[model samples]
Target chain A: MLQIKNLKATIDGKEILKGINLEVKAGEVHAIMGPNGSGKSTLASVLSGKPGYEVTGGEVIFEGKNLLDFSPEDRAREGIFLAFQYPVEIPGVSTTNFMKTSLNEIRKYRGLEPISSVEFLKLMKAKAKLVELDMAMTSRAVNVGFSGGEKKRNEIFQLAMMEPKLSVLDETDSGLDIDALRIVSEGVNKVRNSKNAFVVITHYQRLLNYIVPDYVHVLSDGQIVTSGGKELAYKLEEMGYDWVTNND
Target chain B: MAELKDKIIEKYTSTENLNNGEPVEIKHIRDKAKEYFRTFGFPNRKMEDWKFFDSKPIITNDFKLVTEKQEIEKSVLNNFLIQDLKANLIVLINGEYSKENSQIITERKNLFIGSLKEGMKTKPYILGKYFAKYADYNADGFTALNTAFAPDGAFIYIPKGNLLKDPVIILNILDSRKSKVLGQPRNIIIAEANSDVHIIEEYYSIGENDVFSNVVTEIHTDENANVQYYKIQNEEANAFHVGTTQVFQERNSIFTSITLSWGGSVTRNNLNSYMNSEGIECNFKGLYFLTGKQHVDNHTLADHANPNCNSNELYKGILADESNGVFNGKIMVRQDAQKTNAYQMNKNILLSDTASINSKPQLEIFADDVKCSHGATTGQIDKEQLFYLKARGIGEKEGKKLLIFAFANEIIEDIEVPELKEYLVNRLNEKLEKL
Candidate 1:
């Protein structure tokens, strides 16, 4: 579903992602773990088409389409979703209205008519139940005065609503508690299907326990140092990234 | 300079609304106003109060004063109607009230709802006491011009201990289609002790030629009274507008003013509130949405003269294209206002690189036990907020429109008038579609 070849990106004069090559297939999950300043978040940011990140070399292909050629919005319409680490607080935009606009835009991109408000409400109610998000929270401004756990859950709720072909979760578990982690992971597990893929980017193996990955890749500096099965996550958690990268 | 100042006499005296049958009290006030204008004609950019605004374009034009009232087209009147609004409508055409066009449904005996001319003739005692009482005509050139030359405007007097169930909508329309007409309307609203009322003053013009409207409204909220005033200026793109609203609040009174500027070439709005006694709450909120080459300047002052008073001011602007905006908010906490609380905020968004905004906050606090804070911010649409919307599949254009709409909607969200709120949101969407 996704492929990156020699992806080299730089924010300023310094290079962040030196050379990254990763292949993500349908119906599989990939977990990327790294220590501080190891380019883990940089890989996620580069894949999602954020501005200010210059692609000095190489390309990214999603669903056989050149992803770098599309804008951030077009990438999203093409079924690429990025769950932000910190959800932005739009002062006057209600979450329900935001969801409706996003869903209709994606539908419009797919040559479909806009969804009726009644049908949209039904869809919203069902998705809110799946993620255990309060229905009242959807009526308020997006992420305004929301708790940390609710913000993370809202991200999962949106992911469920979009049903994207590929989702990159960037540090979504950083501010969540144990209960919130389980709820978000379970919501992700329920939304996963045979034709979708997930790239879970985190620092600890605790999140991997809930949503087990098909393969674990430890990123160091810029390149992937090791790729192994789920046990590699527990090993890295037991002995830090120093133990893994030093052995590399 | 002499030629420019001498031309003001011929410009206004040419009108046929003479002093014949005018009250002696009204004549004295006009003469006093004329003397003030003789000394200081039109405000220039050199004055401290008019430093940012240059009145040359407005004062140099040879605008003929509106001599007679003209019939307003039914279509134009229909376009200004609020949907599902249940309120009293007062139609003022070319500065004078038209009873045939207005719908005053209230049959209360004590309520005197009519024109300023009628108020001067019929209720001399009431009109003489409150007219030109609060608005400082000796200082402002436009106020003097309006006082010396204004023919008529809506005058509402609610007697003591009465709560008006229906709001009053003063529809002021200028029929400048005939010529380059100028309109100056003076309005006075008095809510007696313990009375409450809400009024909306809307300015509309149907003409392609130049229309200049100089308007002044004075509101006096007596002890324990309440008042809510709304001023909406939506006229032709080339029209020039200068309006002043002065409010006086007594003990245990409440006053709220909302001013919305949607269309104009050059518009200036001044709103001032004086809290005279304790336990008074005053709120002044304004919003301006400008496109093309439109310009709007808003100045506000909240004076806390007594102890235990609260005042708040929030002004927001969205300037697109080459439009320019200016905001100046002043708050004064007198020494006697020991327990006063005042807050002021001015926020602006410049959509285009050429669009600009100048905002300044002036706070003069003399009381040590008062709480006051003021802030001003001017920037483009938040980049992070825009990108977040775009990343959710909304296109970049749509995302920007959404952010701009949300930014302006924050000010409109606090309106307590349901019908006006609905109408404004629809009108705002219509403008945002082009942006």
Candidate 2:
């Protein structure tokens, strides 16, 4: 479903991702874990085509298409969704309106008719409940004055709404409490299917307990130093990065 | 300076019946205003008040100051009327009242809604007391020029203890079909004690030629009176507009002014309010959405002369292309005006690289028990916000348009009238398409 070949990225003349390669098939979940400043977020940003991040030498292929040729907005319309680490507060734009705009945009790109108002409201109500979001929250400005947990849940709501081909959860569990983590992870699990894939990026093994990954990879100093199954997550969490790197 | 001034004086003295049926007092007042304009000439960039506004374009254009009244069909105005508004309509063709075009649907015994020229003859006492009273002609050149001409304009008076249910809509249309036309319209609105009223002034340029509208409005609110004033400027791209609205608030009175500037080549607005008595509330709100080479400047002042008064001012702008936007808001709290509260804020968004915005807030406080705060900000649309929208599958252009509309919606949401608000929302959407 997604392929990264020799992905070398830089920001402000400093290379962040150094020759990292990864691949994931449909119906599978991959978890990328790393310590602080190990290019975990940079990888997600590069995959989503964020501005200001220069891909020095790399090519990202998503569903047989060269993703680098598309703009950030185009990437989203092509079913590449990146749940931001920190969702920005946009005043005066209701969350429902935001959802409507993006849904119609994606539909247009896919040669589908725009969603009707009745269907939109029904979809919003259904998806909003998956994350336990209040109907009132959708009427307020997007992310304005939202709590940290509410923001995370809102991100999951968007993930459910878009139903993208490849979803990158970048640090979605960082600021969440135990309850919020369970809810957010459970929401992701409900949306998981054999036709779609998710790449969970996190700094800890706590979120993995809820949404188990098919494979686990440890990223250190801008490269994937070790790759293994779910046992790798338990070993790294038990012995720490020092033991994991020394053993590798 | 000499050329325009001499020509105006030549025409002011030689024109027959310019003062026909006009009171002797009004004629003397006109002469004084003309003399004042002659001395000050036109406001240049050298003057502090006119530092950011340049009147050179208006002076060099040689627009005909004396525009003849043009006969326009009623259907010609159908395109500009508010869709669902039911109000007393007063139409002015080139600054003169057109009885054939205006409609007065609501009338009371003590209420007066008609032209200033007729109001002066019918209610001389009211006109004699309120006309040429609050607005300053001595310091402002355009005010002086407008006062000198003081042509026919919309005049409305609400009697004491009466609530005006229907708002008065004044359509000031500039007919520049044949040549450059300059209009000077003076408006006076007096709300007696405990009266409430709403007035809307909408300006439009009908032709492609150069059109200039120099307008001055004087309003007086007696004790406990409430007045809502709205100005919707949808002029042509080749239009130049200078408007001055002076308001006086008595004890326990409330006055609110909102301006929406959507057109013109160069536009400058001056809105001032004097809280002369205790416990007055004053508000000034404006929004300007400009594209192309449009330039707009808004200057406002809130003077608190008595105790226990409050004034709040907020103005926002969205500038696209190489347009320019400017704002200067002054808050003055006199020594005797204790416990006064004054707040001011101005914000702007520049869509293109060349678009410019300038804002300055001035506060002078001599009262020890006063509170005042002001803030200003100018920048491009927030990148993080825009990216968030784009990441949701919305296209770049659609996201940008939405953000711009939301930015300007903060001002439009404060409109008190429902139909007007709906109309403005549609107008804003149309303007955003071009941006």
Which candidate leads in TM-score? 2
- Fnat values, candidates in order: 0.74, 0.79
For each candidate, the alpha-carbon lDDT, in order, equals 0.88, 0.90
TM-score of each: 0.97, 0.98
Candidate 1 lDDT tens digits, A1-248: 99999999999868988889999999999999999888988888788778888999988999999999999899999999999988899999999989999999999999999999999999999999998888999999999999888898999999998999999999889988999999999999999889999999998899999999999999998888899999999999888888977975
* TM-score of chain A by itself in each prediction: 0.98, 0.98
* Tens digits of per-residue lDDT for model 1, B59-169: 888676645668776777899888888888999887788887888877687788878888887788887788788888887889998888788888999889888877899
Docking class of 2: high
Return the top candidate by lDDT.
Answer: 2
Q: List the residue pairs that clash in candidate 2.
A: none
Model 1: clashing residue pairs? Answer: none
Compute the lDDT for candidate 1: 0.88
Per-residue CA lDDT of candidate 2, range B316-393, in tens? 999989999899999999999999999999999988999998899899999999889999999899998888888888
